[model samples]
Target chain A: MNTALCMLAAANPVGHVTDKPINGQWYVSNVTVMLVLSGIATLWLLIPAAKRITTGKSGSIDDLRTRGVLANMVESVCLYLRDEVFRPVLGDETDRYVPVLWSFFWFILISNLLGLVPILDITAALGLNDFHGTPVGIGGTATQSIWVTGTLAVIAFVFINGTAIIKDPIGFLKHLTAGAPVFMWPIMVPVELIGMIVKPVALALRLFANMTGGHIIVATLLGFVVSLSTALGGVSGHGLAIVPLIGTIVIYFLEIMVAFIQAYIFTFLTCLFLGQLVVHAHDDHEHDESHGGEHAAAH
Target chain B: MQAMRFHLALVYTALLAGPAAAAEGANPFVGTIYQAIAAAVVFVTVMVVLKKAAWGKILQGLQDRENRIKHDLDQAEASAKQAEKTLAEYQKLLANAQEEARSMMESCRADAKKVSAELKDQAQTEIDQARQRATEEIQWAKENAVNEVHAQAAELATNVAGKILRRQINAQDQQQFVNEALAELGKGLN
Candidate 1:
């Protein structure tokens, strides 16, 4: 087999890796599509939002009370980010970073949904046939790719520390060696670096593993039916044949649910990291406002 | 050094992964993906136009409608004030006319009574004058009639006396004596 065919054959059951090349460079196939779709969806969502905020014209109480397609969509997305993602870990710091976090939440959500669509799954299904040509709109779970999630995580990582550094240039370095002796600096510095780098890596892998794992399980189950049917001359060969079909269908639905959950998880962690970076536990008044004076009294 | 290590690790991973999956040829999705991109651009352009044109007019129309309603209310209020003033003036005029009519009626009643008294007095004077004139004429008529009666009575007596005398005398003697006596009597009376 040619190199391209060989590469596609080894791409696993999910269409994570494909033979499609852009400018002679082989990009991670699904990641490119996810990023594109996410950008477009973000712009589409933000237009009316920008208009609403800039104009200060709002829908009436009737509009808020009822659900039209556009209103419902905006409300649902905003509510999910606020209640589920931002409120939990961020707590007091939630407001400042809520917008960016919400954007990430929605973007990740749409990309995950796009990955599960049947048309995108065509290339993965007809693996051998895909050697002839790349299927239209072919992609798997975007969350599965390390580079995609890692890039997003790295951006969060930089902004978090960057802001903290900018806020208190002197105090920022002091926190790294906070309570340790002079001798521990050499060991502590490397440890802190690992700690910093590991956070984003963890964020990336957690999302990627969860998303990729679900798709792989569904694909493998479907692949079993295909192999069995070919061996036995037909799909309904043995009584055991019904087992694979039912299992595939069940796993397929489970995979879809997992997609949403993973997207939410990724966004929630991002809020947590941002909160840690920006929130200063030192502000007595702010602490009192947020935690009802408990943490302030303790301090 | 740490940042360098991170970049190196990323590059190493890329190099090791080798043209991912190393299979498949000719991707079919590439042909028409650009169309969606083009459509997105058009959609954004349309949004800009709508925001500028349609939204502006709608807001302006709402404000204009508010102003027009306010103007109409003001006009209605002015007209109502004018009507109230006219009504009050009419009421006052009616009152004045009623007073004038009342005065005129009172005067007419007084004039009628005075004129009736004057007519009664005039009629009384005319009746008195007529009665006096009638009484005077009756007295004068009575006096003239008595005088005429007396004159007739005298004429009768004289005639009778002459007849008696003629009867008593003889026929012949009487004729001669009568002539002589009448001549003597006529001369004496003349």
Candidate 2:
């Protein structure tokens, strides 16, 4: 029963030894390792695709052709993100931000997918849970950790607010007051301010919660099989374990879908939030104002 | 103002940390600021590397393909227009040839009619000249025959008178007979 509880606790961020500080101000957690691995994995796949794309002569027939299925698949995803996802929201500025968004997408996706594998359980079974009393096994989803998601959200927050301010300082300041009259500034300012902070907090929590929650459910379901077996104290309990095992299998498939969904949601929402910050040209605003006036006059 | 906002955010984060830590027994809600810094570093590094390495290339390839497609379409349109123009020119040339052929055929028909009329007039003139020549020749032949016959007749008459005189006939009688005969001959010649 204690072992089952311990395994269930492993689903929590606090249960991992890497979350603790190894030295002063330096901590090496499972998430840190996963981040590095995700980065390496990203490089491994994309570098070859890049080579395939770049090595071809421009304007050649081969340039029009994709290198292979993997390369083509990667390119298709990139094109879809740029054209369908990013362009509609970011407009002309889509190109400038694609690299960052793509990096985030690939990183989060790989991290989520890697978490689905039972590497940590295998390592634990092998008695390699700690390396010389330091938690250094291959396991845990980086995106599941609040710190990782918080970091990503912070970065997005900075990009959104920073770009908004840089693009139009006066407009940004004005936007904060929600375009309200002088009388409403007091109420609107705090609301806008809170809204600004909330965007990043929401981004962080959404990813962290989805990932952590799915993992907790999966671990808990599997723990039921162990607890049932222990309760029966014989082959009878082992036979009953099939029920929870089936349930765990179903949840496992759900977790896979959840992983992809959460990554997409995070990226899509970031694009939406970033899109909001981009200021249209002044001419458009004047056109809108005139149109609004005409509409009011007609009314 | 920015610094004050930053401090306020930090205080807010600290205030939230206590409850978050107490809730999950290990506080999954509040992460160390260092983790956020590490993530930032990792993400930035990944972004920079990817931008330099792969993303730029892929985008360039896509752009190149787009431009190529545009250029090919433009060329195809131009060629189609050229073909249409060529077809129009050929059609015009064909129309001109047909018109010229029609005019040429009409002119040839008119020339044939004129030539046939000229040939008929020439044949009629030759026939008339041949008839006139035939008539002149018949008149000459008749004159010759008549002269010969008159000469023969005069000679025969003189001879007859001489015989009669020789037999003792009167000279005045012979002379009257000759004169009558000569007068009859002259009427016949007329």
Candidate 3:
């Protein structure tokens, strides 16, 4: 039980890196490796698709046809994210922000999926889990780490506030003041300011918690199998171990779903937040008024 | 001042609450600044590379494809409109030709009827004239034949009288006899 708990602990952000120091204050971490791998994986899938799309003859029938299956699939996902998800919210500004959003989504999704693969176990079975007491295997999910998710949230925070300020500085300040009556300014201003910080913090915590929680559940359930086997003697213990093993498998599948859901949620919320900042309060109000008036007239 | 105090209070509360607990031997909230920096660097690098290498190109391609499709559809619509116009013109022309043919047939029928009526009238007049002329000639011929018959009878009577008397007849007596014989023949013929 303790060993299983230690293994689960190893999945967390602080301890997931190798203890072996490469330099004075620098140490190579499993998450760093995963981050690098995810980046490379993203490039591998997208670069070819991009080349196929750009370099092909523009008006030919073959050019209009979807490139290979992989390229087509990638294009479809990108188009859906841009047209359906981001464009409706961001409007004409979708083009300006889509590159960053696309990178963030694919990077995070790949990182989460990497954690689902048992690369560390495979390396361990091959007797290559560690190199001279330094862990050198591919395992940890970078998004499960608070630091990784926190960085992403911070980047989102920068874009959200920066865009708001850049678009209309005075409006942004007024936004922080919450558009309240003069008497309620004292109360509303601080609340809105705190909300700014809280939004990204919540974003970071949500992703980290979701990814870590699913992993912990799977680890704990698997630990039960070993516990049950050890608790009972020999043959009966081995027979009873099958129960938790089945439970662990079920949770593992659930983790996979959670992985995709978390990635989508993170990207979706980020787009929504960015959209809020990009379009001003006055603009939103006008849009609402017009839309409401039209609806009433239609009715 | 009130807003500042509220801000401070919120921060204090957040710090006190801290973060959720982690599994044994791990602190969930405790992340190294180094790792955060590393992650930031990685994210920025990925964003930059992908923006330059893939996203821009992909978007351009999609835009191009949209423009091409729109162009093709516009051309198709234009040609369809042209085809529809041409069909309408052809239908109109065909209708005109059919009307002309119908009118021409009516005129031809009228001409044929007029020619047939004129021919019948001319033929009737000729036949009437021929019949009148033929009757006139026949009457003339009958008169001549009657006169010839009277003359021959008169000569024969004169000849018989002379023969009985065994003497030649005089000129004045012969003429008076012929006149009387011709007048009797004319009455008989009428």
Candidate 4:
């Protein structure tokens, strides 16, 4: 099958049109659908949430029934960050950074799911096969695309450090040279700069590598069927074909879980970084002192 | 804090490699998508408006609930005070009823004693009148018996005088004596 036909075939699980590929580079595949769906879903969720936060009525009757789902889901995510994730690490400074973290979580999650579709699995599926024969959206995992993950990382990088600088300009700069004495400044400065840039970059790669590696492994495993077919001249390949098919089924479920997890990890790390910058070092010191005091009194 | 920072550095080091490799691609920086840029603008605008509105309304709701609780508490206290007053009044009424019953019993005993004394006096007076009438009847019977005895004595004395004249004189003298004697006896008896 041609690149366009393969993509169209993969994009629609049902075989719609068997012939006539679309002209030029304009194309929609499974990955594209996943991307569009995610974007729509995210917006659909955020609009009512924005309204509720502004109006503060729990909402009107229609709003309660219709827009309530997305609003409720966003609120739950926000609440989780505030109560469980942010408060534990960042302490009282949690509130200031929660919105940004919430945004990051949802944006990354939707995109990761977009990467998991089979239309994006082409290059990986055929084992480094020619791109000319593959469909547009059929081969590129969205999250695996360095551009996509890198963009997300960059946003996190700017927000976390930016908020920190705004909150405590001196402290934000000083955190770079924080570990040792005045003599260590020259060495620490370079390290801190690198550290600053590395935070988001690492965030991007973690997501990218995980998605890419999983896709490649599944594709390579599926290619075994073709190899066996060739080796046994067709008969033995058919006998062993069911094995790879069963394996593909199991991998599919694992990929779904990984998609959600990778999204969480991306969001989680971003929040942790923000927490480090925004929360005061003195508060943590006080907490330690109080804890020590209790321990001493107990003794 | 140092440990946390160190951990973050480790995490970032691992991730930086992915983006660096992707930087070698045909178009490393694709700028931003139109949808993403739009979403970011919407996010900033909505967040500012929502922050102000949410904080204000939530605080107001808390205040309203507080006022309602205070009003309910005041009403309960007033009702308790009124109930206490009613209880005190009932106790006073019960005490007054007991005192009146005691006084009425005392007066009833006094009036009963006075009535008993008047009845005894009236019965005594009637007994005295009955005894005087019985004594007067007995005295009249005794005086009538003495008058009957005096008339019998006068008749006996006249009889003795007639007998003495008969024995001493003749028949003719006797007859004349009898006549004179009868006249004298009758005049003496009368």
Candidate 5:
């Protein structure tokens, strides 16, 4: 790997740790394919679910009353995310951002889950790891890549601050001083600024690190099983391998749970950040209204 | 404090996760710009596609369902109110009907009572008239019968007197004889 080069492919366990050429194009790699696949999976899953949700043009009572399991399950999760997870924070702005938030939720969730499928290993085992003398992969967790998560974080950051700044530019700038006196700008501004930058950076790192760490843990346990088998190289070795295999199984379960959790965490944090910024518009409006009421009362 | 801990854990994991890249002498914190761009591209594409395809329709459905339910509830409430009003009106009408029936029955009863009393009086008058007529007829007949008997007796007495004497009697004599005979008969009855 060129240590300094920034490319579309990143390292993984079973496939190319570096971007490889395929049909003379170096951009194609496992995470790329997985991202595309995740994108497709997201669309494939949600399109039908969307149909089930939409009912019809008239949206009749009986149609509204019933739904398929897929629609119901998808709807329950979406509702939870929309109403319960972020509604308090996002307030009136929840709808405006729900599409983006849901996209992130389902896409990231699917990507994270795809990583656990061992498709990369299966391809590598089937000797499809190298195709036409170029390395490629069929599956891996797209969200595990820092580029992917950081990009998502960057998008969230943009939306959060951009909307705030757009809606209330002066307030957005004023918030940089951490609500302290003008004299405190020397300290509070920088501190608040740092806090702002750190938030999204933390979101990206949290997801990337969690995903990377879980896979690593599972791999390490499996590595132990491999070493155990290799050291004895027989039935005894296979007998010795059971311990790490069990550990791998346990870690794999945890990884599965973590995949969902990390996706939820990313979405939840995005909403919280959005709420933190956008909800101020409502507060400002309320403040103005209160002031107006007070002036009227005085009159 | 919780956010700080979350960031700390992330930092700790990043350190733990980056050994292979570290050995490759790459900064793990930084990602490739191209991949970063790809990530943004892919995510934005998803957001756009989903926004177009699913989110709008799904949210609209939810809203429509809510509105439908609200409308159904309102319609149901209005219908219930109307039913209640109709029931109350029917009950009121029924009460009026029953009152009218009761009043009519009372009127009929009173009229029947009046007619019965009138019939009783008329029947009594007719019965009294018939009894009076019957009593007058019976008295007249009895008077006639008595007259007949007196006349016959007078004639017979007159004849007998004449026969005893073996002589003819005149009208004036006969009258005297009839009066004597009647007086003798009256004395004998006493």
Candidate 6:
């Protein structure tokens, strides 16, 4: 068999086929399909949901407030991400960046959820890998790919830094000084620069590591069932297979939770990083004063 | 045979993965730059498209609804306060009307009592006057009857005297006889 053919021939119980070099060229992969699919899925769910969440042309607030579960869930998550997550850090500037942050959340979350769906595995089961003697791998976890996650981090980094520069160029420059004394500027600035680069790198690694680790674990456990049952070859083979099967099931459910959590962590950290740039010291002071008054009143 | 075939394939796949994954680098974390570029394009497209499609409308709606709810609560509170004030005013008016009616009733009763007392005094005076007049008329009628009887007795005595004498006596003697007869009638009336 050809090396390129072997790349696509490998099934899910074996490994991720996208990891191989089919033709070893810069071409679209399963990750690309997942990217496009996740985008479409996000749009499909939200486009209609947005209409329900929006106040009707009748100008009735009840229309917005009294919506169905999908609308309510979307609205609540958006609100929690904005008011609880973004507003605390971004302050009044929260609204300006809510679109980007919300996009990050929904896109990443949907992508994460899509990864849990075994599209490629199902395709392999259907024996659709060969297309007229050509091997085509059509599914994989997009976020599990380092390139995909790196791309997301770079986008986040650009938005975070771009807003910082545009919003307050002076403060953004001062941030490079790392709030150290004049004499310490040389060392602190370089350190700050590296830290800035490291922030997005960490984001990329975190998402990639989380998705890759969990999905690979589930696949490996399920692969054990296949390997063990075939190797053992009898009632004991099937009976021993139950252990890895149960393990796969358990990890599969855990992957679902990890999917949501990783999405939240990625978006939250991005928001926090953006806040560090866009929001200022004075803004924090003002926020503290206002919230302090609110806390006192509440008590 | 099947078991051997399956395990052999796993080994086969593992062998195949090593070389291809190492094509870029010995490091597994090494990325394909072009893949990143493609992903960047896709993510940007998704984010930009969704920002327009959904985020703007949802945020604006929440803000507008909050403002409207605050406005509605204020209007409701104002309306409730106005109703309370109007109710108090009406209650005061009602109390004043009740007081006025009670005072009027009291005054009417007082005036009736005063008129009734005055009428009773006037009737009493009229009855006293009628009784006095009746007593005076009875006394005057008794005196008139006594005077008539005295004149009749005197006239009888004069005629009797004239018969006994069968002639004309001295005028002084006749008159003396009649005077004696009037004195005797007055004594008898007393």
- After best superposition, candidate 6 residue A50: deviation in angstroms? 1.1
Off by over 4 Å in 5: A1-26, A129-137, A281-299, B1-31, B72-190
TM-score of each: 0.50, 0.66, 0.69, 0.49, 0.65, 0.67
For B36-59, candidate 2 gives per-residue lDDT tens digits of 677778888888898999889988
Per-residue accuracy of model 6 over B78-187 as CA lDDT, tens digit each: 99999999999999999999999999989998988888888888877877787778778877777777666655666676767678767776778767876787788777
What fraction of the true interface does each of the listed models get right, in terms of native contacts kept? 0.01, 0.42, 0.42, 0.01, 0.39, 0.40
Give iRMSD, candidate 3: 12.1
- Comparing only chain A of model 5 with the true chain A, what is the TM-score? 0.84
TM-score of chain A of each: 0.73, 0.83, 0.82, 0.69, 0.84, 0.86
What share of the reference contacts is kept in model 6?
0.40
lDDT of 5 by residue, B1-190 (tens): 5455345333332333345345442333433566677778888888898898999978877777778879989999999999999999999999999999999999999999999999999999999999998899889887777656666888876787788998988999898888887787767756
Identify the candidate with maximal lDDT: 6
Superposition error at B134 for model 1 (Å): 99
Q: Which of 5 and 6 is ahead in DockQ?
A: 6
lDDT (Cα, tens digit) per residue for candidate 4, span A74-146:
5556556566866776776665566566656666676566555554345345554234654332334446555
lDDT of predicted model 4: 0.55
lDDT of each: 0.55, 0.72, 0.72, 0.55, 0.73, 0.75
* Residue-level lDDT tens digits of model 5 in A187-253: 9888878877987888888888888778767765565465455434467667767987998899989
Candidate 1 chain A lowest-lDDT run of ten: A290-299
Quality of candidate 4's docking, in CAPRI categories? incorrect
Residue-level lDDT of model 1, residues B48-136, one tens digit each, is: 44345333432333234345568779999999999999999999999999999999999999999999999999999999989888888
Per-residue lDDT of model 1, residues A1-299, tens digit only: 25423433433354333223333334434456555665566556655543332222253333223134663455556655765657665665565556556556666676677767754557546652334354444555455555566656666676667877887776567545543588998887677667667767777677666666666666555544543443343323344346777997998788778777777766766665555545556344442353332223222
Worst 10 residues of 3 chain A by lDDT: A16-25
**What is the C-alpha lDDT profile of model 2 across A1-299, one tens digit per residue?**
36533433443323432244332233565567677777788788887887676536654587578788788888887788888988876877888888778877888888899888876667656765354564434566778778889989998898888888888888788877766799999998998799778878888888888888787667655655655555443566677667878998999999999887777777877776677666354344653453344234223
Candidate 3 colliding pairs: none
| Stretch of 10 with least lDDT, candidate 2 chain A | A16-25
Model 6 chain A scores worst on lDDT over the 10 consecutive residues at A5-14
